[model samples]
Target chain A: MDPFRKAIKGYDHDRIPVWFMRQAGRYLPSYMKYRQRMGIEEMMSSPDVIVDVTHDPVDRIGVDAAIIFADITTPLSGMGLRVRFLDSVGPVVENNIEKSGISAVEEFDPSSFSHPVLKAISKYRERYADPLIGFAGGPVTLLSYIISDGVDRDLFRVKRMMITEEKAYQAVMTRLTDMIIEFARMQISAGVDAFQIFDSWAGYLSPGEYEHFVKPYVYDILQELSGSIPTIYFSTMTSSYVADMDLPADFYSIDWRIDMKRFSAEIPDEKGIQGNLDPAIVNYDYALHEASKIVEAASGRDRYIFNTGHGLLPSTDPEKLKRLVEYVHSVNL
Target chain B: MDPFRKAIKGYDHDRIPVWFMRQAGRYLPSYMKYRQRMGIEEMMSSPDVIVDVTHDPVDRIGVDAAIIFADITTPLSGMGLRVRFLDSVGPVVENNIEKSGISAVEEFDPSSFSHPVLKAISKYRERYADPLIGFAGGPVTLLSYIISDGVDRDLFRVKRMMITEEKAYQAVMTRLTDMIIEFARMQISAGVDAFQIFDSWAGYLSPGEYEHFVKPYVYDILQELSGSIPTIYFSTMTSSYVADMDLPADFYSIDWRIDMKRFSAEIPDEKGIQGNLDPAIVNYDYALHEASKIVEAASGRDRYIFNTGHGLLPSTDPEKLKRLVEYVHSVNL
Candidate 1:
């Protein structure tokens, strides 16, 4: 069995499964070489390019799993929104979905929307022996990007809709949840071994708001996907809500702000846990030593996956990341 | 006694003390009127202007305490860095302090540095009857802005230095703590009633990293100032570190992420707890109802001060804020 599968099953393996989020992107110099030649929209929408970049970090850093190369907004284009990846500023929607525009958001049909991602997943699965992980933005997170220009710290427009137009907000969230389910199912059918749901902006909500507005949809998505394959629920900057998050996925991915041991104690042993390492540590001089501290903290915990609390930063050193993987493998688990 | 003083003293009053972070900011039209005329640097440096802007929110919104209107980076100007508040981008240093430039960081003297802020505090105290709250940036947060151009989310350079150049990082932190102590003392001596230390970026550290790299200096600042008057140690996005913080302050101001009831249960009643309504909720359509939810959560808690978890946003409606204050004061505590 693959190391990722073994770790998820809670079997005693010689080494823990390890993967860094965003491992395939800008951090790798080779990936940047290709990125310079094409725009983000073109690079992500091409199956051949997606497969190449997806395989880059695994080839260079030797991580345990290979996540498919695709942006979360890949499906948004088919949903009647024009997504643009601007410089300095990140992914922005040229046309934002207001309450009046809610009727314009069509249900994302997997066959028509994001066919390139599915094709890339199918192609990459044939090439790589390691577990192929699939991912999509959580429903509310994707809604945040579509309704607002991009993921906002304040989430002003998102919350205003949630407050002022409750019916419309629910309709959009429900549709997005259905869309994510369809998207994840398509990736799973394409031979992806596991799935990760990235709820990056869920931290902006109050616990009450999260429970009322966000949790049910998240629970529904995990429930739909859990029986099919291992599902990882990753929410950044939402550590305070962990104890209250009753969703039972195979793995819960934590951010660096919370202690791994404390987080482990809160969840059941059968469930797996991945990440909480600060990605910024790689830009520093003591990357190796700092990575070792995370390793020590995670040791002896059942089903713990070695990964960063957040995505690997754009400026991450590939050599440092390679060293980190070597060190994680060398640890006596 | 002022309502703010009553709450801090753990005394029961007719109404709870109400204040919002960034109460005197761009949200007010009156502030923008002055800001349009003079630049941010010039406005902050002028005592007459600072006094007027600081009074705007108190007069318009009817809050209890008056936080002096000044940027946390106000003293960074005196420490050999030139500060500029750009139009779109917030505060930026014209010349950011780099690792190679660490030697240039100088200790701030109250008499020599930030004299304008002290002058503003003195002038405001004479005009206002409400307890004056003075504040300065915590060592790590100020260090982050100084080393990096602004408050970086990734905190790449800050983390790198903490790992690689440990001694230089320590030197900068030590001087910053001393400088903050000196800067805050000047405000207190100038007749401010209490002090708040804003460790806004400390949430980026792991518990161990926080305890190792950030906590000691924070503990020192609060420890030194706690005897003189109430000290509020406010750190944004760091509710998970509360148990491990071990840094004693008279009141621990938390962001809206944590449950207020749970937070109050964890801390002592005599030690006041301020804050934690999500500032974004103010922008919502049902601002009053949402603000009431926060009030309900904090209803029975002792020594609770009504305030937003973070600073009020620039687009936040002053009328909504005024109504929230009116509702908070109307509640039977």
Candidate 2:
């Protein structure tokens, strides 16, 4: 078994399995070359391009895993939402759920929209034995984009809908939860070794609001996917409430806001923990020194996978990431 | 004694003293007239305009306290940094600490620069029996703007400086801490009832990083101000590790990411707790209903202060905020 799989299974390994949230992204020169040739939507649709981009970091940096080269909004296009990737502004939904309503998502065919991503996963599986991690945006996070029609820093529109229009909010959340499950199932069938649900913006909600509005759908999705594959639930700025909630995932990927030793103590030992070196530290000359501290914190744990707290920045130097991977692997358990 | 000052002293009050961060800001129609007439710097410098803007919300909304109308970067001008307030982007420092070096801050005289604000505070104290709160940006938050030259979401540049150039980072941090202490002392001397240190962006650091890089300076400022006047420390997205650190403040104002009941329980009984209604919710028709929930959670605490988790949005209706204050005030312990 691969080191990542072994670690997730709670087995002691000789070397820590290290990968990054955005290993197959703009920071890599090989990936940037493709970005110059075509738009993100075009690159995502091309299985050949996806395979090349997914393999770039694994081959070049010797990372333990290859996350599928796709956006969290990749499945939204299939859900009847017109998704566009702008220059500075991230994924925008032209006809969002707030404008188009729940009726807009009624005709979504997950298999049809997810074909490109699924195809890429299958092709990558054929080419490499390394694990291919698949992901989808969480229900509330997806709704944040869909309700606002774009990237909103405050996500007030979504919260307002939840408060004043409870029934309508539940209807949309149910549809989104179903669509996400279908998308995850398709990726599983296509041979993804692991799945991560990115509830990136869920941290913006209060614990009470999260428990009331978002947790049920997250629970439903994680319950459905648990037996099929190892599941990882990822979020940022949520450590205050995470320990109290009983999330059923094989692993939890946390941001770097809390100490790893403290977070590890709070979480149960049965589950694995991935992540949390601050992405900003990678730019410094002493990047490896900080990386070693994160490694030291996870030293005694049988179930540990090394990764960054968040996605790599666009301006990151790829050589630094390559050095980090080698450094983690060299640390003996 | 005023309810706000009474509550801060951990005394029983007839009603919960209510205030909002950015209470005197863009949300009020009266303040907008001044904003239309002058730039932020001009408005802040004109003691008469500052007094009017600061009183607008207290008179109109009936909030318990009046925070002075001034920018967090108000004292930077004295430190020899050129500050500009762009339309959408926040305060920008033309000659940032990175470009101008520690020598740029050598000639700062806090009293000379804080004259307009002190005059406004003295003017407000003569006019009202209600508490007039004063504040300055915490050392790390001030350094973030000075180092980045503008608003940077990630604050990567500041983090990089701390990692690669520890000595320079310390030198700049020491200067900022001393400046904050001096600025805060000027506010207290001007007859302000209470002081708050807005460590707004300090939440970006990990607990370990915050302890190593930022906490000592914060400790110095809080220690210096604790006896002179009631000191409140405010930061967002820092709930995860706040309970562990021994911060010496009369009040800890937190953002809405965690539960009020939980946060209140974690904090010791001697210290006061303020804040944490989601500012976004105020735009909804049911805004007061949510505000009431916050009051209910803080019902038993003698030292509790009612406030929003963060600042008010510019788009917020002033009527809703007035109604919220009424609602919170009506709640009996």
TM-score of each: 0.95, 0.96
- Residue-wise C-alpha lDDT for candidate 1, range A1-333, written one tens digit per residue: 877788876777878788999998887887898889998878887989999999888789999988998888877776777889998878988777853388767777666675688899999988877788999999888888888666655567788888888898999898889888988888898999889999888888877778888899999999988789889999877787777787968888988888776776667767788897778786554556656776776766768898998899888888878888888889887
Off by over 4 Å in 2: A285-289, B285-293
Clashes of each: 3, 1
Model 1 lDDT tens row, B110-218: 5666568889888988887878889999888888787866666545678777778899899989989888888878888998888898888888887768888889999
Q: Model 2, residue A198: what's the lDDT?
A: 93
Over the stretch B225-281, how does candidate 2's per-residue lDDT look in tens digits? 888899999999898777766799988998988877777788887888899888888
Model 1 stretches astray by more than 4 angstroms: A98-100, A283-293, B148-153
lDDT of candidate 2 at residue A177, scale 0 to 100: 91
Evaluate candidate 1 and give its CAPRI docking class based on DockQ: medium
lDDT of 2 by residue, A147-256 (tens): 86577546687887899899988998998899889899999989998999999888888887888899999999999998898999998888788876788988889898
Instruction: Write down the worst ten-residue block by lDDT for model 2 chain A.
Output: A106-115
lDDT of 1: 0.82
Q: For each candidate, report its DockQ versus the true two-chain complex.
A: 0.67, 0.71
